[model samples]
Every structure is written in C-alpha cells, then in structure tokens.
Target: MSAEQTQASGVVGVLESVGRKSLGLFEEIGRFFFILHATVYWTFRRPFDGKEWLRQMVRVGVDSLPVVGLTSMFTGMVLALQTYRGFERFHAEGFVASVVSLSLTRELAPVLASLMIAGRVGSSLAAELGTMRVTEQIDALYAMATEPIQYLVVPRVGATTVMLPPLVAIANGLGIFGGYAISVALMGANPVTYWEKTFQYLDLNDVSSGLIKAAVFGLILSVTGCSKGFFTTGGAEGVGRATTSAVVMGSVVILVSDFFLTKILF
Candidate 1:
C-alpha cells in the first residue's frame, strides 16, 4: 500500500477503536439502568426476606467494622499530628481540633469507610454472585420459580443502604476520638480545649452530610457488585474479573460522587 493510504487507514482504525469503546461504555451504562429497574420492580413486589437483609447487613457492616475503624482512626491521628505541627509553627495549634473534626465528619470518614467496604464487601458480593452465575446456581433459582433479583439483589442493596450511615457515624466518632487522643494524650494538648475546639464550630450539618454520602456510597457498591456478578460470563476467569471490576468501580464512583455530594451538601 502507498504511504498516504496506510496512514489514512491507521487513522481510521484508531477512530474505529475509540468509537467501539465509547459505544461499549454506553451499552454497559444502559445495562446498569436495566438492572436498576428490575431491582426496583422486584423490591416493591417481594415476599421480603428479612433474614437475607440482616445477613447482608452483618456482612457489609458488622464484618467491615475493624478495617474501617482502623483506617479512620489512623487517618485522624495522622491528620491531627500533621495539622498540629503546621499550625504550631504559626501559633495556631488550637485550630487543629477543629480541622480534624471538620475534615473527618465532612470528608474523610465517609470516603474512607466506603472505600474499605468497597474493597471487602463489594468484592465478596461480586465473587459470590459471579460464582453463582457461572455454576448455574442463579439459573437454578429461576428454574425453581424464584426471581433472582428479588431473592438476591434487593436485600443486599437495602441492607447496605441502611447500614452504611451508621457505619460512617461510628467511623466519625472513632476518627475524632483518635485525633483527640493524639492531640491530648500523645502531644499534651489540654483535653478540655481539644474537646471544645472540636465541637465549637462543628454542627449537625457536617456529620449528617457525611452520613448521606455514606448511604449513597453503599448503594453504589451494592448495585455495581450485583450488576457485575449478575452479568458475568467466561466461568472462573469472569468471576475474578467481575470481583475486581466491582471493587474498582465501587471505589471510583464513591470518590467521584463524594465530590458532587460535598458541593451539594456544603
């Protein structure tokens, strides 16, 4: 082929690839909405399994406590330590408590806790559902006159949505406490001053905003995980891919949505 023709064909190939990928992304987005519709439909029409909802709550919330708590606590400690050093240089050390409290309740707690749950519970949901999809277990449910979306997806999504707010609330407390411990016990800041400073400018709005974000993040994780697993193919390999995708997508959506939620709430 002529050089000019070859270059033209290469350009066309690149454009085609880009177009194909864009189309694929949109197609997947459409599938997500379809799944959402099915879930909503089943949710209102259900026999309503309380056992599954509670089980998933334990799995997504209770099982995740230690990891989320540790992450939030250390984050607060590091934040306090860093801010104390910086603020001390300017003789504004008192603001450290306020900064730590605001930062934790407004941003860090929900984001960090959600990210932890995405890694743990999101992957677990995806892996479990993907395995069922591959092993014909989900199909068997259909064959047995059970609607899989009702039997499976609603409970998970509902439980996560309900539990995440409380989880983030606990995380907020632990994180704030960690900051207090670091400032007062470790660095010898006055305990009374620290507590006062922490709550002085803080109010319900800050904490409530984070909890709202947490609930949204939970919905995102459950929906993403369930969708990925429900549509999984290619056997074990697909299951692994679905699990990884669930975690990655859940984390990314949580972060992206956090920015928008912060703007709206604050």
Candidate 2:
C-alpha cells in the first residue's frame, strides 16, 4: 500500500477500535442498570434476611459515616472558600451560606458520599463475591438448594439502597456545619446573617432531590459491583478485574446519572 493510504487506514482502524470499546462500555452500563432494577424488584418480593440485612446495613451505612463525614467536611470548607472569594469580589459575601448549603444539599454531599461508597463498599462487594465465585462457593450454594442471589446479592443491594440516602443526609448536615464553621471562623461571616441567608434560600426540594439521587447512586454501585462479581470467570485475575471495573464503572455511572437527575429535577 502507498505510505499515506497505509497511515490513513491505520488511523481509521484506531478510531474504529475506540468506538467499539465505547460501545462495549455502554452495553455493560445498560446491563448493570437492568440487574440493579431486577435486584430491587426481587428484594421487595419475598421475606428478607433480617439479620443479614441489619448487619450489611450497619456495615454500609454506620461504618461509612466517618469517611463520609470527613469528605463532606472538607468539601464544604473548600466550597465555602472558593465561592466566598468569588462572591466577595461582587460584595455578595453574605450569600456564602446560601451557596454552600444549596450546593451541598442539592448535589455535592450525596454525589460524593455515593462515590466514596462505590470506591469502598462496591469494590469490596465485587471482590468478595468474585472470590466466592472463583472458589466455587457460589456454585456450592446453588447446588445446596440455596439461592445465591437471594441470600447474598439481595441483602447487599437492599442494604445499600436503604442505607445510602440516610448517610447522604447525614453527610449533608455535616457538610453544612463544616461550611458554617469555616465561614464564621475564617471568613468573618456574621453567624446570624449566615444562618438567616441559608434558611431563606433552602427548601425541601433541595434535600429531597439529593436523597433521591443518593438512592439511585447506591443502586448503581450495588448492582454494577454485584453483576460484575456474579458473572466473574477465570480466577484471581478475573476477580481483580471485576473489582476494578466495579469501582470505575460505578463512579462513572453516578456522575452521569447525577447530571441527568439534576437536569430532570431542577
């Protein structure tokens, strides 16, 4: 082939490969959502494992608090600082509290919390289940007259869905406090005025929308992790890949879904 023709063919091949990978990614994402919806449907169908659900709930929600709180605190502080500086230039510094609270309650707190959970809980779920699948424990369960999906997947998904929103709400509160502290102590914001402005601008919709987003994000994490793990083949290498994919895909899904939710809701 001529040199230029060869180069053009190679470039086209590269673009085609990229397109194929992108299509595969979107397909995996679609499957992830479908599995999540199915799991949620199954979760409400029959009696749940109360003890297992309780334990998973505590692990996912209560145990996640410290990390979530720490993340939210710093996020709120940074938001206040950056926003305050911009508003200060316009002599609208008093709007800092409103800005901080509205942003956190509407998006940041829930989205960040969900991403953190996906990194922590989602990876773990994938690894654990992938390990079981590799070790043949999942197969054993299937042979024993036990349903792996019901016992393992359902409780985990149920726990995440039930737990995440409340955790996000808690994160929102902590984030607000963090903003309040930074504004009053560092920025010289008047405490009374700050609270007044925050209250004036805050509404139930902001909080409710954020919580709803949290629930959706939780489902995404749980389902993607579980689906990847459940279908995992090979051995340790496969499990490792699933774990990595779960976290990365779960985070991407959260960000994408967050945008669409925001657009639809607000």
Candidate 3:
C-alpha cells in the first residue's frame, strides 16, 4: 500500500478501537447502575432488618471515625496556613476564618472525606463481596431462601448512606479544629476570636450542604462497590478488577457530583 493510504488506514483503525472501548465502558457503567438501583429499591421494600443495618452502621461509621478525624484535622490546619499567606498579602487576614470554614464545610470536607472512604471502605467492600460471590457463599444464601440483595447487599448500602454524613460532619469539625489549633499555637492568633468568626460566618447551610454531599457520596461508594462485587467473575483477577473499579468510579462520581452541587447550591 502507498504511504498515504497506509496512514489513513491506521488512523481509521485507531478511531474504531477507541469507539469500541468507549461504548464498552458506557455499557458496563449502565449495567452497574441498574444493579445498584435494583438493590437499593429492594432494600427499602418489605420488612426492614434493624439489627443488620445497625451492625453495618457500626462497621462503616464508628470504625471509620479515627482516620477521618486525623485527616480532617490536618486538612484544616493546612487550609488555614495556606489561606493566611494569601489573605495577609491582600490585607484580608481577618477573613481567614470565613475562608477556612466555608471552604471546608462546603467543599473540601465532603469531597476529601468521601474520597478517603471510597479508597478505604469501598475497595474493602468490593473485595469482600467479590470473594463471597466467588466462594459460593452468595449461592448458599440463595439456596437457603435468603435474598442476597436484602441480606448481603442492602444493609451495607443503607448503612453507608446513613453513615457518611455523620462521618463528613465529624471530619469538618476536626478539620476546623486543626486549623484553629494551628492558628492559636503556631500562628499566634487568638483562639476565641478565630472560633467566633468561624461560627459567626458559618451558617447551617454550609454544614448542611456538606452533609448532603456526603449522603450522595455514600450512595456512590456503596452502590459502585456492590455492583462490581456482584458481577465479578474470573476469580482473583476479577475481584481485583472490581476493587479497583469501585474506588476509581466512586471517586469520579464524587468529583462530578461536587461540581454540580457547587453550581446549584452556590
């Protein structure tokens, strides 16, 4: 073939491959979303499992507190320090509290906490459920007339949805405290004044918005994790793929949701 013809053919081949891959990705995403919706809908149907939901709440929420606290505290400190430098230059130093509190409560706290939870908890959930599926435990449940959707999946999803807001709120508090501590101890700022500004400028809407984002993030994490696990095949390799996908997709969704929420709310 002539050089020009060969180049054209190669370009066409690349385009075809890209198109196919994109289509496949969309298909997988659609299937996963469908399964997630079904699982959540089934969870709300019929009688509830109070005991199981409580267990999962403890597992997801209570156990996650320490890490969230540490992370948020540090975030708050860094935010304060960073904002101080810029604001001081602009003669807007007094607005530091407003900047720190608003940023954390509206954006950073929910997004960062959700991403952390996705990495730590979502991946674990996918791996655990994928293993159970591979090991025939899901089958055993089915044989015993226990709906896997209700027993195995629903509680986790419900618990995550319930737990994430609280976790985000905790993270926000810690992050603000971190900023406060740093300002007081290192920056020589008055603690009472800093806190007073924070509370004064920070309204219920700020915190409430973060909580709303947290709830959405919780849904994204749990649903994606469970979907990946439910459909996982090919044994260990499949489980690994599911775990990775769960984290990546959960993070992506969180970012996208953040963008939209910011636009709408702000």
Candidate 4:
C-alpha cells in the first residue's frame, strides 16, 4: 500500500477507536441511570427493611463523622488564614469571617465532606458488594427470590441520601468554628467582629443550599458505588478495580455536579 494510504488508514483506525470509547462511555452512563432508577423504585416498595436501613445509616453516616469533622476543621482554618492574609493588605481583615463562613456553608463543606465520604464510604461499599458478588452471595439472594436491588442497594442509597445533609450541617458548623478559632485566637481578629461577620452574610438559604448539594452528592456516590459493585467481574482483581472505580467516579461526579447545583441554587 502507498504511504499516504497507510497514514489515512491509521487515522481512520484512531477515529474508530475514539468513537467506540465514546459509545462505551455513554452506555455506562445509561446503565448508571438505570441502576439509580431501580434503586429509587425499590426504595418505596413494601416489606421495608428498617433495620438494614438503620444499619446502613450508622455505617455511612455515624462512622463518617470523624473524618468529615477533621477535614472541615482544617479546611476552614487554612481558608481563614489565607483569606486573612489577603484581606489584611486592604485592611479588610474583618471580612475573613464572612468569606470563611460563606465558603464553608455554600461550597467547601458539602464538597469536601462528600468527597471524604466517597473515598471512605463509597470505596468500602464497593469493596463489600464486590466481595459478595465474587463469593456468589448476591446470586444466592437471587436464588432465594430476593431482589438484590431492594435488599442490598436501596437501604444503602436511602441511608446515604438521608444522612449526608446532617453530616454536611455538622461539618459546616465545625468549619466555621475552625475559622473563628484561627481568626480570633491565632490571628488576633476581634472576636465580636468575627462572630458578627460570620453570620452577617450567612442565612438559612446558604446553609440549606449546601445541605441540598450534599444530598445530591450522596445519591451520586452511593449509586455509582453500588453499580460498580453489582457489575464487578473477574475475582479479587475485579473487586479491587471496582473499589478504585467507585471512588474515582464518585469524586468526579461530585465535582461536576457541584457546578450545576451551585448555579441552580445560587
């Protein structure tokens, strides 16, 4: 074949590969939406497993508080320090509280807390379900006429969806306090001024907006993790892959969705 023809063929091959990958990505997205739909449908069905739901709530919510709190506290402190430094140049140090509080309640608290949960809880859920998949436990449930989506996925999705708002709320408070401690105690900003400005620009809408974002993030993480787990193949290697994919996909969705959510909420 002529060199020109060969180069044209290679270019065509590259285009074909790209097309295939793009199709595969869309297929995966479709599957994820289907799984989310199934989970929501199963959630409201009869014969509810309140015990399992509560157990998942404890696992996903209660167990996640420490990491979320630590992350929020440190984030707020660092944000306050940075904002104070910048504002000091303009002699607007008092605005540190407003910035810290607004940033935490409107963006950082929900995003960071959800990312932490995605890393910790999402990976764990994927691993657990992946292990069950490889071990045939999930198949066993099917054999017994039990729907895995209802028995397994619904409780988890419901728990995370219900619990994340409160977690974000707690993280918001901790983050604000962290900023307060840094601005007032460490940076020598006036305590009264800090407290006043912290709430000056903050209102119910800001706090509720963050909580709303957290709820959406919870749905995305749980659904993605569960879908990855449910579709796991191979064996131990597959379980590991699913776990990693869950965290990566969860984090990505959280960030991507955050922008649209913020635009809508704002």
Among the numbered candidates, top lDDT falls to 4
Worst 10 residues of 3 by lDDT: 31-40
The estimated TM-scores of all candidates read: 0.97, 0.91, 0.93, 0.97
lDDT of 2 by residue, 142-165 (tens): 899777888899999889999999
User: What is candidate 4's CA lDDT for residue 65?
Assistant: 96
The C-alpha RMSD of each candidate to the native structure, in angstroms, is: 1.0, 2.3, 1.8, 1.0
Model 1: per-residue Cα lDDT over 1-266, one tens digit each = 59999999999999999999999788767766777789889988859898998998998889889999999999999999999999999899999999999999999999999899888888988999999999999999999999999999989888888899999999999999999999998888999999999999999999999899999998888888888899999999999999999999889888998889888999
After superposition, candidate 4 runs with Cα above 4 Å error? none
> For model 3, how does the per-residue alpha-carbon lDDT over 1-266 read when each residue is reduced to its tens digit?
69999999999999999999999799778966786777867876776889999998998999988888788889999999998888879887677887888999999998998898898889988998899999998899889988888887899888998999999988988898888887778887878888888888888988998899899889888888888888788899999999999999889988997899888876
Task: Give candidate 1's TM-score.
Answer: 0.97
Kindly provide the TM-score of model 2 when superposed on the true structure, using C-alpha atoms. 0.91
TM-score of 3: 0.93
Query: Model 1 RMSD to the real structure?
Result: 1.0
Whole-model lDDT, candidate 3?
Answer: 0.87
Error of 1 at 49 (Å): 0.3
Candidate 2 overall lDDT versus native: 0.91
